[model samples]
Target: MEISEMNLFGREHIKVFKNRPKAITEILSDGVQQFGEKVAVATEEHELTYKELDDLSSIAAANLQQAGIEKGDRVAAVIGNRHEFPIMVFACSKIGAIMVPINVKLAMEEIEYILGHSKPKVIIVEQEFTKKVRQAAEASGSLEAGSRLFEIEGENTFSSLLEQNAELTEAAISEEDGAFILYTSGTTGRPKGAVLSHINVIHSVMNYKYVFQTDDTMKTLIAVPMFHVTGLVGQLLHVLYVGGTVYSMKRYQNEAYIERILKDQINFLFNVPTIFIMMSTSEKFQNHSFDFVKKVAFGGSPIYQQTFNMLKQAFPNAQLHNAYGSTETTSPATLMPVSYPEAKVTSVGRPVAVADIKIMDSEGNECEPGESGELYIKGPMVVKEYWDNPEANLSSFTDGYWHSGDLGIMDDEGYIYIRDRKKDMINRAGEKIFSIEVEDVLKSHPDVVEAAVIGIPDPVFGEKVKAFVVGPSLDPDDFSMLKEHCRKSLAKFKVPEEFEIIESLPRNASGKILKNTLKQVGGEKNA
Candidate 1:
């Protein structure tokens, strides 16, 4: 079958890449020479021009060399969305060190698992999270009980690069060498490390640049956590790849402050649905100017129609764009123009350049037009492998296509619509929550015989968790106590909103609870 028959999404937006780049270093080396003296990264602390970024990266590379880090070494960055974050990634690429961006938003135990598996030579973390880093290190026994962590604040860390020689190093990598190790949400099992090659990294970034028509004139605000591929690939990596300026935000909770900042010089934005939801609903957005903000790209999860429509209301001249991708694909696999209000509201758009998408049924049979099924992608931008994980690598790919594990349908016009997750993962405020984890916790209560977890629609959190428990001796008032138990054991976000004491759970012959049956009977209401 042709690309169109297999992929419901349009083929025009997909970018084809010739897997060649050994590293993304050249994007920076050339960008600095051309856009030198132009602002490349900015935080409240300091601003770096493209030349200075080039210089700092060289220095950081020198430090890495002196520290015994070489080709294929894993370099972890536990910092937030600061200027130092991008610098470290570029520096790692220079010396062939795979960049492993640790999610600072995750719990300490979650952080420990990533650091342990990645085996980073050294960790660059913010001082605020210094203790957490140390704790995580201790938890994993990877570093000394008390390992000294490199700290970054203002331009202080960049000055460390100055202390070293700012000499460039020759690339010692191939297209197959690991360029990045991005951890999955770990919603089900432990997080899997998706190793993206340099060529894959460059392909995804270049796709973002070309598709967005980004240029030196384009300045994007960086608010999404750079630890995720969406943030690293779309906001930080793509900016350097295309010679654009980045106004960095350490955290995005302050919607008003972010709007005040983006109100000024930004022409582009790459944020998740929540970021736009907060901005479009904020009082600050009520008065924000959009003279420069052009293409506002959003992904990570679905956005509500209310939040989608408000974006245009706030930015009368801005065009919305939807980017559909996963950690395994760097950032975007398909990007459809969300220019029209209706399109922006419903479709996730079309498959991006070079991306081949197919929606298949349970038996791997191709779904008909407008039929929802498991989404699979094949492209140069696909991850090379899961680091040190052959079993995961084997399971991840089928006939050279990466199984996205997401249920989606393609329309006649190449517009993709997401239905649900195949793995029973709950998207709570942009964070993936494994239903099994919550179920395990609830089942541990001894009184509960069977438990099933499902995501109920929430206005704020794309989906709020609601667990239905099938057990004896539980009253309506007992739910508060059960919820409290969950609070003590799991993350607050993982705790269920409400619980129903059902006589019995609906189950198939395989003994698997039919969660859809639960949703049919009053589960469609609120969590």
Candidate 2:
């Protein structure tokens, strides 16, 4: 379908699409009936057919019920990319429970915060990480004495739990009911759960199906972390919705990723540009044949034109797409049409058919074409609210539209180009690093007086975290000590890659850190 045909709103400038499933369970049930024996999902360890997927998920639901889980309860999972991850997600949907996919790389304190905020009735974790979860549970003080903790790996594990229960009767679920609560760092430096509904996820699935032109013949390789919305909704759920096969890896290993693509004859690849760069530069990439690959979609971080051109040469037959969205938008709010790779290479493309995008000024007035402003999105795919966060809701949403906090401009032709971010968030190789979160950790140091963090341009990772600090000492060893302090509380990706000891940070009269000045200072220091 062409973009013009899919645009449901005209001069009014709103976007919408039709024919979304009422609930995610409908997608699961329909997939089973339509593609019963077809391979649905494959991991390094196991593969499941559509019918088998349905049966296993139902069994998982029964097991949860047997453990006292019921509708409206929360189930948090800290497992990696594997067959059980999606199975547990579907099982939660089957029983009308909310799935909370926690980032496995999160530190104990970060995990504790989410556990305390969500108060999940159960937490399913990888065997190796059970101790961390247990610590988090203890720290959060939210886990009841009877709360279940299921390890995904071991003899009596996630798989064995499935075998113990029979198929369960699917619960009646509403389109508006919460399906997943994806946690993202807020401006306040704490993570807020973005509550995505069943309709929200289905809307995203439809958007992916329409934009990617996916069908039953398509075979996808998912190397991105399944806990992230890009991999979960954009890759896994989208492929499931279209009755295609999904080959997932536990974690992205550069060499293994290339091997899997060639081995499985993966036709569709949706990942960030970093993986694409790694694959293209690898000796194995040039030696192997990618003739079977048909489509390549990338997002999460900016893609350089050089990398884009290299990718085109690597997969000659593939159609390249640049997509843009967030956890709040389910997956993609905008996708660059395959036709615009050359002419509009830098733009994030127009809003998806079902999503409305507007660049609004501080006064809430829509900006004229070519003018930059904060991006606001409105659609069924947009998240309803941050779970239990009234402050976030009051600040983020206005007039039924969610403020994206991304500064962008739309050309007269309707293609959107990202200019800058209004929020103090860093995108390092597709991993989000909130500056406040990092700064909070840095300032906790005994010797630290003040800290300011910013994103500095990096050729490989798009942006790398850089911190400027004013402390009692400018000693080089002190920088290492501060980094170690952050390591205990922050994810590896959030740790500042570069640290500069400055006398003082640039600030305005009102005491707000002048980040633009810091960017300039960063550029000068690098120069």
Candidate 3:
């Protein structure tokens, strides 16, 4: 099928969608009125019905106003998977504040950089992370005198702000207004904030609803972090849009995740491939009944064919889907059709109703079917631009399409199959690890002369980081010290899983490191 024909098919599919809300606040209001007594969100500690959610968000909005937050203000949150996170998100929407959800796994330096870049008016964090956030804010000079740092749970916490019974005076929020600023790591060793408007989020949610065929009866167990587009826009917000219930988990523990799936009778689930691999291979997974699950989606990293087959056998009643997207695309631009799982097992499936995907060559010309090229996506679900980063915007977007930097190909039927990456970014499990970022840290060591980082295939994690170094000492003891040095600056996931001493790194005439050669070397060592 032609691209235009595919798009028409998508639009036709979207035409049947009913009762769609224009903004986030409207979604909340509509949910409360329609699903009133139904549960909207739940965690291990508490549950909130739609009506209760509406009431609590109003209080939270009032609290935000009392705390001096104005319309268009940025509010950063460093909390885990909790009920209050969604409350804060809806509260921000009602007041026209931009909610910035920080990734809880980030190191102190990473957090400080985000706080400095976003310069939020208020920082809401869990009590455990309060000191770290405070320190980060202090270092970034974002914690000005009188700026509030509210904890998720504590004496003077987010709940304390809800004590006021004052009526919430709604701000004039528009569909075009920014709703979220999610930070995504860049290849340049810095994080870029993707500004997602209300429209962007709504379109993304619609994509999920249409692709997954979700409804009010659907119950999802959100194992992913809310800071990610998949968990927030795909699972959480989409569930709200359809008047469905969401069971939130603070963290993913294999056993705990399985228990919740069975106990909660979760019908919908979306997680990375690694989580599925762990669950399917576990002894407990065989004993439990997954009869309640209706849909299971996996993305962010490649799934082994063996694991995919095992999941199919494990959940015979559930529709297994493969999704493809990035933070810039909100959640998923493409979702494998449930009906064609076996036929298109390797494909990420076709573009969603609101999205348009194109494969372009280096010269910006569209590639023929089955021809590999960089994938570009255009849609309302795609982020407008990177927050305050003109350089990134200039390079990443062209002719209204966001360059995904992912190498892919499309078949005659419009299904997209991702082949490789155009950038040197590693998908370790589901975590994005840029090689340059780790290489910079490795090169910082005084004993190191030069460093090169490459990703090697792993059975559990999709890929593992391996470093090739040219240093003064090639001893095993010296390499161990180098690994320790990396641990001090980089996240544990980014640290090299294996180290090799090399006299020199192979480079092209332009002096660019030939990472392919290093990948081969690393592969041979693993073999």
lDDT at 43, model 1? 79
Question: Which model, 1 or 2, shows the larger lDDT?
Answer: 2
Candidate 1 vs candidate 3: which has greater TM-score? 3
Query: For model 3, what is the error of residue 452's alpha carbon versus the real structure, in angstroms, after optimal superposition?
Result: 16
Clashes of each: 12, 0, 0
Error at 224, model 3, angstroms = 1.1
TM-score of each: 0.76, 0.79, 0.79
Candidate 2: residue 263 lDDT (0-100)? 83
- In terms of lDDT, model 3 sits at 0.81
Show the colliding residue pairs in model 2: none
Give lDDT tens digits, candidate 1, residues 1-527: 11221211122233345343447888787787788888888876789998888888888888777767778778877888777887887888888888888877678998898888888777778878877877898788767633335767533353565566545665677766787898877655788999887767877887787677777776777766778787778887787777778777775665745654665567787776545644654576667566566777887655455556667676666778877888888888888654444743657788876677999998989998888789998876888678889898888887768899888889887778876668667889988776756876786685675677888778888888888987668889889989988998899999999788888776422123566677666444553
Q: If the candidates were sorted by their lDDT against the true structure, best first, what order would they fall in?
A: 2, 3, 1
After the best TM-score superposition of candidate 2, give how far the Cα of residue 61 lies from its true spot, in angstroms: 0.5
- Residue ranges of candidate 3 with Cα displaced over 4 Å: 1-19, 186-188, 425-527
Poorest 10 consecutive residues by lDDT, candidate 3: 1-10
Q: Quick one: how many clashes does candidate 1 have?
A: 12
Query: Where's the lowest-lDDT run of ten residues in candidate 2?
Result: 2-11
